[model samples]
Target: MTRPSLLAAIAIASLSTITTGAFAADQLVVASFGGAYTASQSKAFIEPYMAEKGAKVLTADYNGGLAELRSQVQSGNGAWDVIDLELQDALRACDDGLIEKIDASQLAPAADGTAAADDFLPGTLMDCGVGTIMWSNIIAYDKTKFQNGGPKTIADFFDLEKFPGKRGLSNKPNVNLEWALMADGVPNDKIYETLATEEGLNRAFAKLDTIKKDAVFWGAHAQAPQLLADGEVVMTAAANGRIYDAISKEHKPFEIVWDGQIWNLDVWAISKASKNKDAALDFVKFSTTGPRLADVTKYISYGPVRKSSQGLVPEAIRTNLPTYETNFKTSLANDLEFWADHQDEINQRWATWMAK
Candidate 1:
């Protein structure tokens, strides 16, 4: 009630308002498929996302992104605020009721996500998750091992006589199975179709057996570049970004054969239970916007999901990625939908085959 006490109270109130205002400007938590993407998000997505909304951003892991959502929904105790889900996981999330339908009205009618306006990536922006980063499954090899410099087609991956060395592969069956079938002379376009048949599965296993002794099945992303750098394996099928990191940083004599590269994406989705759903959605919107996307794309080596940001990225960083333009003459686009349906069956066969 005294004048000095009143003055002190006013000063305290002013300081609280300033602090809260600054904090409110930008602050959101995102669980994304981590690794290079996380670092890139900090540069391309998070920092800018924060600046745009006047909020500070935090990042976490949810590889394949929606796995955490699936686990949370199954356990009935969700923790993530927002996630960078993969397409298959996004589909599963919807079926499992882990995600709330995105409120389209929250976004501008002309916002990049509005498909009727033809702004979003092909078939990515419905009520499901949005694509944020895109990369490819590429054939990376040590140039020093081959006289002709290496094989071009997927079949060459099986030609141990011509390009003899230990090999590496992703532990997952989704992409590697296609490479297996391709090495067995299955057409790239018919890869998933053939794999659906028992004969195709047999042939893939047969091809895998040829290199089983020399193969190092990589269960983690970091293992590929490390295996490549330390000479643990001579050549392998690897994600383009991981190989890029190895060669780009250490100047490792490596190259990617894009002949049968598989395009992959990381999708962003909001948790159904997130009290900060609106704030999370705002974070997604801000992260995918032009300025932040371009900045992040440079270091991450993943292509921007938003078409608007493509022009903003520097030419050097832009050329390193597999863009739609680079995909023109090459074979790409694996059957993600098919994998979603048969991952369990294929994974079983993969385990059996690897055991042999």
Candidate 2:
């Protein structure tokens, strides 16, 4: 071949290499709490987005917290482009400038053309993050554990003489404090207000003290269901989705007690330091559409945050969601603002209580 022809061939090869390198770098890394929750997201969001956009996606799982996200941001080498955060963590991360500010205007509207901002449930759309799903923490008991009707209320959870078995509780103080306050006779509307004072704090701990010895504390989402399945704890505080998966898929004889259930939102936020910020934001937009949000319910029991998505969910799945009328009757929405202000102090106290 002539020298000119050889040069042309070399140029084509170099261009192909550059294009491949750029395409590889365009992939987005998303992080979230693992287990059935992530599985639902994989089916409902990630896989579909990749297929539609021809983009590469990677996933990382972390038991929920701000420590790993903080480390990544502070070090200026963020490994995750998109992160799924509990509402309080999202608030704190946004305040500390750890995540990118999202523009709600860019989100897709409802099928009927309602604005995205107005379509989302109140308190879900934030400056830095967009809410994805609403999930709840509730008491799950083995149906076979008690011949008599099992725990029926939050108060029953603390009654050792009546329930007569080891209890499973999350190691975190968030829901436990609220449940303690509720079980101790504080009214639902007064829960956070009651927990704000010194006397209230002591009262919660004192109520918790009633079952500390018999309580088995679990730190991860999966552990709650496993504790009950393994018979380590007769009843455990579990994510509703996890318990639903165990019952529906594994055919476990577990039942969820929705009384005094504490529900919260999981938000999607972009890392401030992500090299793929644009791609990350695009994925977030795509995943949060009403159709996509509703699709998640087909896999897990979590309720979609979009008001429009509610209609998309079938009646069978809708009835099992946390937002279902019967299930939500006695539920309490977690106060993200309260946790944002009090998490550090509460965590410190939680550690002390755990030690004792």
Candidate 3:
């Protein structure tokens, strides 16, 4: 071949390589609850998904609220492509048309070939969100505070006379209302039923009033553990994962109380305004599947949403998981639908109650 023709051919080849590399390395942003939870997600899902899809997964952190997402959607400026949020937030976002409706058929099936619909634990799959983990709101106490034995039940948490310490609770109404009713002798099965009525609502608030004077309210998941550790409060209602990190990583004197634990699902959803919708969908599908979901447990104790993923979790950590045999038996599922319907009313009431 002529020298000029050979030089042109070399230029064409180099251009092709550069274009192909650019297409192969797509990037997406995932917003999640930060700290140890985000770290676990990066290791278990983001890194592996990047390796497989030849994409970059940028991580952002939030305090588990939909305000930022709503702002982006309203302003038409999409910053995050995907988010890890609680089930109730996902439902609200979907209703407000801030998030994309997910096609469950696109989710990866179980290892045994079960369809995604049949494989995901009940209530985990939703209209807009795909649940990734089965986590719980648990009561964690400092072992040093309870020398003989720690508070065991939800009632004990509210009973200052029995447990006898300043308690720490999240500064939200979601799980606190349920815990109050449960502690007030409302049966586990009837928690939502009681919460749904005026009488039930009054009962819960009355119960909360018992401890309101002595309780220390925490605004973040990380703060709950810190409160217990710094001797600010002897006991706190914590996300099971945060307490797990406290005991396992920070070497704090903490033990989780399984009784009255409110189990809930943490889900992933795509923003409707996301420019990278296709890439975000691909990332979500890859992460919530069999091995990937279960792999998160190695870093944190939350159970995988997929039933098939349970077997992949090591037996040693099984007891710590929200789905563990003992823990599962006593826990109540967080009713996201109910919360979705009444969140505004409850929040207003909670604010008023807190102020008084």
Candidate 4:
């Protein structure tokens, strides 16, 4: 009850109010593909937004899929405020009313004052989502295996006789099927169209049968790089970012073949059930700007979705990006619509094919 004690308590209360009042009222929960990918996003997007808006930002990880988002939305009490989603998943979630629709005008425009619609790469902007990065699923080989030369084309990856080693492939069928058809002599632009036909499906599966015996399948992103570094498989069909991390961080002897690379965009989506929907959309707008998008490439090799961000990417790593002009010319743009429509049936066929 002393004056000194009462004064000390008053001072502490004032300090608490000053600190807490600096931040926004709502706590934002963001979900993403974890590890380095999320790490990059945290540095580029979350940290700065929290600092500027004084918002409390929390993060969670998920294997890329709509199931978790659906669970949250359908339950009507979703914990996540925002999520990073694959384009196809984003499209489906928007259609299913699992995520909030985005207005492209609400997004920040280019540094040059170009409209957001004009600044973002083709197919990067969508009705319900805005893409942040363009990533590739491509082939990578252990440099130690082929000192003189390695896989120069997608077909080289399939030629077991020439490469003469076990191949590592993702368990998912999307990229694998695309690669199979391209290697089987289908043109890069014609891959998805060909895949839509029964004959094309048969051809892709038949081509896969060639390497099925020696192929070592991986279920996770990290496992692909580890498979190459540990020499379990001489080469892998892997995300370019994983391969880049292996070579740059782990110092693994890996080489990427950009030819016939299947590339797609990863987008940010707001949860329809989120209590902090406006704050979530605010974060999306802040993150998708050119400079913010460019900052991400410092941690990962994925290309920024904004065309302007390309100029900001470091020169040394420019060629490594999926959207790099020279590399993109030979690469395949993954058809998000095709996968969105056919994912279930294709996945079922993939399971049956794998079971045999």
Candidate 5:
């Protein structure tokens, strides 16, 4: 996929704006995390697949569809052909037989100029669900507060006396719990293992208690960046992409401390009863292939799923991309299994935590 071809792909995608008329009334309704990000996905893969397979693609929201999926499965009328879910959501969906097992061999092979899925980070690409985007809950700080130097680690987040201010924290246990445990003396390497223990969760909450009344619990992605940019909070947990956007716009001394950041793995899974399974699979294959993925990341600033996408970027810009192995080395992968098993209990605790 060269620059010209990339443009051609976008043009084809733009024309696909036509109402998937009767040529193929069949539709593959997808439940996903919808945003401008999905637009990039539509241009890069969905439209291409629609044109080639003569199929209709419908979009739906994921949070609203879980109950619908449960009901549809009971009725034996599953409507979704594919789902774009967070890592843990995909795992839970797979367990409930809401999705089908994917065969990697059926996907497009990486050859010559075409970027292939194999070029992705090992273990991130899967037989069924593949990670589509990379995001991290990194340490975002006010540059003006520390113009000469800024807070750099989980320890700094805990160090109120040295670099203290109102902090923004995710209400969820995934990243916040990990950050909490990290604050309580858990090594980055041992963060997840610590989280598996009763003491670890308690310890994490206890650490958070130190700043509880002062912490602003952002309920959505948009909130954290807005809070930081508006000085609603000085240092806090933030998504890397949003943090970057704020830094670029605010021109404030905002900087991200990647150390001990929690990585969010957004993954894609295909429906078991998809009408266009082959083409759906092709879409997945095309979406995650390194070159197209690289292009998507270059445009969106979200980390690419492929390991080699980092190479596609210029040396200077590579630092901003999460494809770099060093970035992966520093960030902790979310404990999807832990979250899957304890989501109910954790939700209760989070609710209690929030009530205070």
Candidate 6:
């Protein structure tokens, strides 16, 4: 099927679940990054919510950014009711009034009676966003390409002489900058502190320049895995869950290297211009419950935000999660506040560097 027609078919199928005939007024539109992540949300959150509320829920996919949400809010015609955003974008959007502020009291408490605020991990809840999952961007490579183990550390990713091939990196400056700094010998704890300065920014760009000619920049999550599979790049930086999905479901030989993995939260925020404010808020409350958050692990490798949800995750999947102790030992939590403060300046710098 043609791409447009296929999307139309998916939309029709989603609307059909409402059991109501051709009613568009009551529908809720949710926006998220596409691929395995959205598929997991569809199973663990959207489908169940639709079944219980008998509400039509349409899904829209986007490469993560604040531009679309910003445009919708400015024009007062938001097409999305709820959106999944990276931590930095969520913070920026909430501060800019592009999304509605959520009352913590309105959220459902854990099954054990703990308050929602106390149950969620520290820094997960924000004024306008409810934390959904904790995920990571890690180095993933085809195991077959490396006979004697693989690039084991963040530094090794930049060592083209040791492991020669094209490298795949996200086109954005967020994680790439962090990885570049780490690979250049900046300690994890001191990453943002160092990056906040002019010299540090130059250091990161200089490190990245080493691989610029051989780098394959990908804009979407799915492209990372496809690049490795097609041998377009020997190794790529990818979301941990995407690599996990490819390995476990498709039996791909990709392996994830946890060293210097940059982890962050994905939050669900309501667009300020949403037509269905109350319904959208209700959906957020429903989907973030302890049980619902835990249920998502059945579909993806992301860790749930609620403490109560941790024990509920199956043992098999728990070890694969970004929160798993062994995997997290060398991980760095992406500093959302730092990015919120410096994103514009850094992005401008990144664009200039790319042009060169």
Best by TM-score: 2
Question: Candidate 6: where is the Cα deviation over 4 Å?
Answer: 1-25
Ten residues in sequence with the least summed lDDT for candidate 1? 12-21
**Candidate 6 accuracy as lDDT:** 0.86
User: Per-residue lDDT for 65-163 in model 6, tens only?
Assistant: 889999999999979999999877887786698888777767888998998988987777777788899999999988898888789999989999988
Please write out the lDDT profile of model 1 over residues 127-227, one tens digit for every residue: 55655777778888888767676777777787888878888887778787778887777776777778888888777777788888888988767677778
* Model 4 weakest lDDT span, ten residues long: 11-20
TM-score of 5: 0.78
| Cα lDDT of model 3 by residue, 249-348, tens digit | 8899899999988877788989977877878887888898989998999999998978888888889989888878888777887766578668889999
Model 1, runs deviating above 4 Å? 1-27, 65-67, 74-77, 108-117, 145-148, 324-328
| The 10-residue segment with the lowest total lDDT in model 5 | 10-19
Candidate 2 has an lDDT of 0.87
lDDT values for all models: 0.67, 0.87, 0.83, 0.82, 0.66, 0.86
Q: What is the TM-score of each candidate against the true structure?
A: 0.83, 0.92, 0.90, 0.89, 0.78, 0.91
Give the winner by lDDT: 2
Tens-place lDDT digits, model 4, residues 1-356: 01112112211111110011122447999998776778889999999988888888999988888778888888998899899988778878877988877777778889999989779866677767788988889899998999778989999999999898999998989899989998999987688889999999999999999999999998777788888888999999988998887788778889999988877778998888888777777888889999999998888899997888988988887877887778887776677667866889999999999999
Q: Which model is ahead, 1 or 2, in terms of TM-score?
A: 2
Task: Give the clash total for candidate 1.
Answer: 9
Q: Is candidate 3 or candidate 6 better by lDDT?
A: 6
lDDT, residue 192, candidate 2: 88
- Residue 41 displacement in candidate 6 (angstroms): 0.1
